[model samples]
Target: MKAVCTVLIACVTMFLVPTAVAQDARRITPEQIDRLVKPYLDAKRINAISIGVIDGDVSLTHHLGTLSRDIPNPPTDQTIYEIGSISKVFTSLLLASEIEAGNLKLTSTVGELLPDVSKANPALNSVQLVQLATHTSGLPRMPANLDLSNVTDPYATYSRESLHTYLSSIDPAAKPGEKSEYSNLAVGLLGDVLAMRSGDDYDVLIRRVIAEPLGMTDTGAMLDPSCLSDSQKSRLAPPHDANLDANYNWHFASLAGAGSVFSTTSDMLRFAAASLDPPDNDLGKAMRLSQQKHAAPIGSGVAMGLGWHFARDKQTLWHNGQTGGYHTMLMVNPKLNAAVVVLCNTAMGDVDALAGQFIQTIAGMNVEPKSFDEALTVPAETVARLAGQYEIAPGAVLTVRADQSQLFAQLTGQPEVQIFAISETKWKYRVVEATIEFELPDSGPASSLTLFQSGMKVPGKRK
Candidate 1:
């Protein structure tokens, strides 16, 4: 039910490599996702998840649950939800579109696209456009100078000049396409350069090139959805977090291309339709090119095209997104002209696993409905005993709290999150892919606790 959670990594929402098992799946309906997702909505774990399924010539959509816990109204196809990094797919398509129009090429270096930045930072000169698209660019996940104080609205203050300053400050990370890293900054810079070259706003470019031609009027670069027309603002579903707390809607100042598209399932299904069978237009040609594998990204076993991640089966191209408040997943199979997209208004641990399970069920595979949370029942006394504060580092404490029915953990300077019990002393986080194990002694409160995440273990002593 939950996978890993990342900060500012709405994988291009959490762009971990997709491991969805591909099989001879039978025809799946839009209702399949609906049935599978009711529990989360019923429990108020998620506000709503708008779903769209495309199987061959048939396509359908469903908006499950209500718009929010307080709002009893269900979301409509026109309900706006942030697609997160799925905007990267559209950004890559912009690159493809530019290439198709003879305005750019994969081999075009960053230096060529933005000579001023490249001149200041020669290392960036060798970074080819394709590397940026495939995330082979040597850029770190984000700029080192990024203001951490505003994690929820990270890109709000990042400007073109900010990117320029960072580019000038650093040396090249590697030969273009020499490394495998999932970088929001790399793709953000790519969009900046593309916009600089085209002399248009990133949003305007996407609307001109992708949305207008495809008739996806409901989709566009994410802005303050509330600032738009009154009608659209009302249509925008409010965002929530895993705690069901009110969450912020992310805005982009310079990284809209990285993760800044507000769209609906119906519009996304249209995008999927185009991906399954590209039209004869120039944009269509670019779409065709984007779906092909262009690089073997370095860090993981994931294969990548322009902005798409190739699943292990190498047949399904998919991407998932998680911002502070919203989570999104998009899967497309061009060969079968089939696809499924799930977009939610609240943050969950892993919408990818949820969607992946739905994919398995559609294969006519028997996958019993199971909860992706702490399932082992522990006595209330054990739960109460575990509640305490542990010191991980100077000024960094892990606080564990428990109500009679549920357990929660909060790190220093971070929001409190619910933790589910998997064993007598082990608990896992549903927000991100991490876990904590209590270092219990023979008796008394647990001696210590260890945080496990991303292959690292940090020990925390009783504070």
Candidate 2:
């Protein structure tokens, strides 16, 4: 109901208090952060957020607001928020570790691990594992064979049979090395290949190699109720749209390299710190290489490293995540030995601006992020008329509700939050880190709405 899009403030505004033991601690002051973020959070109508920062060996955790808009659960360092595609970084590390150990090869073909894959499409057998992991393997966001009947759980319905059928008919839209396109299917398949090559399940491989060694007990693909301590499990807040009933779930598939892992701020801090400072393990150098720039001239002004994404001109290596009702951003700057983790419980609230603002403050750079009101605009009449629910498709419906003179969008099986009007016809929602815009195609569709995200847009007929 409130401003759903929050802006980022400067560091001095975030930390107003002269930090204690300022001479020793190189951390940003809490007062300065509060001065900067609190008002922004209020203005954006964010329900709950857990932020973590790492500088050298010292890490700072900050929690503000409640976990749920309805229940108001307080967030803490241990709060487990689904770090969306950030899971790819972990999966990438796993692949890198295996490659470093000679258990797997980046150039290995998927057919080597899954024999049936070659039988489906001989051409696909030549696609190297690295290309799949880097999303340059020419796979689409998802398999064309998938049926969207299970909208509530997209991946849960994609079984092995469906994957095989899709691969058997694989016809790449482009040459493998021609361009860089983000493919959830490609990376997801990479995870499965790594697991098969190592003769270990995704869950087991991660724990045996990465999680257990780093003391990241709370992070994993699936949480066992019997294994997790009450306190540890309690740290998980109810994510956006209590209707979803649980944190986002990733169905096991060959495409595991894309996104599947779940973790908390505390666990991520440990992971980020290890990434910045390689421990006495084979993965240390491998991860460093993974975070380095490996591809270029791609979308996001950067290219894929081993499994990580690197900025074009900066030492900042980062990845963002979006699942059903969760959005996450994790970044680390090798030059600064500084890492940041931004986790949110709500799906539709914009936190990217907050992340940028926080980074500027921590880096002592001055920048002003646009606020929600300034970030969005729409005609008063259209804003008023578009305040009701509309069916985007036959079985898929989205509700656009007006709250506090602001517009919010709610898709079935998702969390509800105010939407930011980025333009006259475009609305951006954070739940899936995507944008939806309406358009009237002059030649064909007189009245149609289009959804856009990550440079890809699809038209949806208004129902």
Candidate 3:
């Protein structure tokens, strides 16, 4: 189930809204925001959702649902929520700022910053600062030695010592700048290295460089109780899981640079606004540099900037993040000078879809309701016959089981979700837009299945 909760950082551009329509598009009314978000929140059982829209000089925010089912507290623009990997953009901004100050260079190697790391893995000697920011450092998504003691707060105990130990033994899967692989380890190490060069801890450095300059008072790696007033603290939304149950907040002593920031919608929108039109200052220069495409385009028409990923086709820059109990999305269309922020208290909420719809609405694009095929009634015996384990990859298995009259698919390390049968062979998840097609042989039960989602299909063989 933990693997199921892993954030899928997919940035896709749907259809581009016309420039004329975008220019004429007015601010999104609270009523319209509710109409776009309420149905999904109700269907997913998400406790709270807050959205902020920035159209030119106007800012509009809408909040829906309570902070939690038990405590009927509505989240305001000031209510803090854990905004996971969105912190990466902040880290990249720090890198860009350092570069602007001539304190660091994009060509600076990891070996140059931390000799011990290079001594342990010479491959890291070739990993450049820009590679780390653009996710081209050849680092894995997570360290191979990451053995979590507590599932809820997985990164809480992973200290700087743990990071150094992992780096001392790990090897890169590819050459530096050879390919783009999303790596928390890479970015976290970048943050750590930047801190080393600046004589500050990751949190302190972020505040002094990005947060303070931008007037983002409520955004930080550590949200100090003293900094928040009693009312703002009361408005803080409790984290919730897919089932809307209370979930623990994540702590990342070493990996905080990767995804460990709590922020309010207003604070994040302010940051987003700064990104759209950076002021004439050192930090502003860094902001502009961060939006520059420093590397080749990653898959899905997404190009890597310093910290931001650009959707070239749609002419938008965006990033999204998910923690154990929360999901947040920030999208900015610099061309239209429009941005949308969606913050959800529940990890299961589809904030990405919500943000996409919000952007489309503000851009004056038609958004059609998504439709799914009717489920076909299959015999119990037939359903039972299809129940088996399929190998998605080495050490990864997709288990299909018949739960009474319903069929469910559970991938290894992922939560089990019921699949609706489109026919006898095709099935889809109700909550997410994904389909599974079983490959039935001529004379036996299905031996394999293909997963289709986001324009990619992956085949899995029955074990």
Candidate 4:
């Protein structure tokens, strides 16, 4: 009934990138940008797009389409959006600030800050602050005890006690600093520990130190109706799905560090400005430190720097975030002193590619990032043969079905999405880079399938 980001994959900061190389510096006209972006909106692939670009002394803002299918007004700087994993960048900035204050060290262990958690699970004591900031702490993407009862607003009722309980329940999947795994739990924990030590809640700490000083007033952990003025409340860009259908916004309770931010394009541009040019202040130094390469390569052609994700061979940095109903991307080319911020009211994976193009174009790099949308048409009979329910985990099922000539896939607690058969058994999603490959038994229904997403191979067996 709803086109959601899927229960298990919601709020995961994943990107499908097409590489960019610097050949020459070129600038496209505003008309060109409209031509590049309006097609997606016109095709109904998304509801709205808000992009901000800053280069040296030049700045521009572009808005396309309505805020939602029912809302005919275009978005403005006042329009607020949930920034998803981009929130991690702010959390990590606070981490760097703490280090600058001589309050915490990169080598500081979880046992030192979160003693109670480590006391409960001794193995976690060795996880260092660097590992947490760099996604090398070996923590899972999410807490296993996370409540999904309200999939739309999944994190609303998650208590701090729940987070502690989950932390104390299991040993890390890998040794601290041994491997890199994008963990919402680890970063969220880092924020919590920093807050505990700083004598401020995460939201208040960020506002008082980070956002307030930089004049980014419209940003914080979450948007509470009671805290906003009438004009501000009316400016909210209500969340929506890929179909331009209404969708519920995410709510973060205990793990707000993971992705609870609600900010506007202008506000994000303000943050990006600070990132491009660090001031002679603690927060600025923290920003500069957070942008340096502090760890090995992460994701595709990127490395982790505190919370920021940077290119391996270029002076470029970026991070993308997605929740159930929104997708956002922020990119900065410090060497070129240029940055771009992309905010969307719809939940789809295309924002990464769009943002990449914007920065590459502005930086004068050849601006085409290869997309993973190359799809193939398969026989209707093959689609029908693969139609069945596959159990992805203990209780999670992935249901595949064939309607007419189209094939669709639906996770147990998520909405059904159309899939394109690239081959007899392999299918890909247009809105996301995920794929599914079914194994036929040669006689009847498919026996199993493998899901390929963000470099993780998840298998499912017929139920």
TM-score of each: 0.83, 0.77, 0.86, 0.86
Candidate 1's C-alpha runs over 4 A off are 1-25, 172-175, 225-227, 297-299, 374-425, 436-463
Model 1, global lDDT: 0.75
lDDT of 2 by residue, 108-220 (tens): 87777767778767777777777776767777556766654454445655666777778888888766656565666777777766676678867677777788888997877
- Expressed as tens digits, the lDDT of each residue in 1-463 for candidate 3 is 1111353223243435546554556456787787776666656557888898998778888888888878787788888988887888998999999899998899999889889877987877888999998888888777756654365777767777888888888767778877776777888788878877888777788879988888888777742344345665666688887557888777777777788777899899889899889989999999989998898765543578886777644467777777778888888887778898888888753467778778778777767543324567887767776789988767567889986557887665444556778887887664345678988766567889887765767789988
1-463, model 4: which lDDT tens digit per residue?
0112342342233332234434344354567578678657655667878988886778788888888657888998779888888888998998999889898898999888878888889988788998888888888666777755565787767777898898888877678767766677888888878877878777788888898999988877772454445666687788886556788877666777777778898899999988999888988988988988888764332478988776533467777777778888888877677788999988777666777777667756555434344456777777788999999876578989998668888776455667776788888764465789999877788899999865668899988
Those runs of model 3 whose alpha carbons end farther than 4 Å from true positions after fitting are 1-5, 8-15, 19-22, 222-233, 298-301, 312-314, 369-389, 393-435, 439-446
Steric clash pairs (candidate 3): 1-413
- Top candidate (TM-score): 3
lDDT of 4 at 16: 29
For all candidates in order, the CA lDDT equals: 0.75, 0.62, 0.75, 0.75
What's the residue-level lDDT of 462 in candidate 1? Answer: 87
Model 2 TM: 0.77
Model 2 RMSD in Å is 7.2
Q: After superposition, how far is residue 329 of candidate 1 from its true place, in Å?
A: 0.3
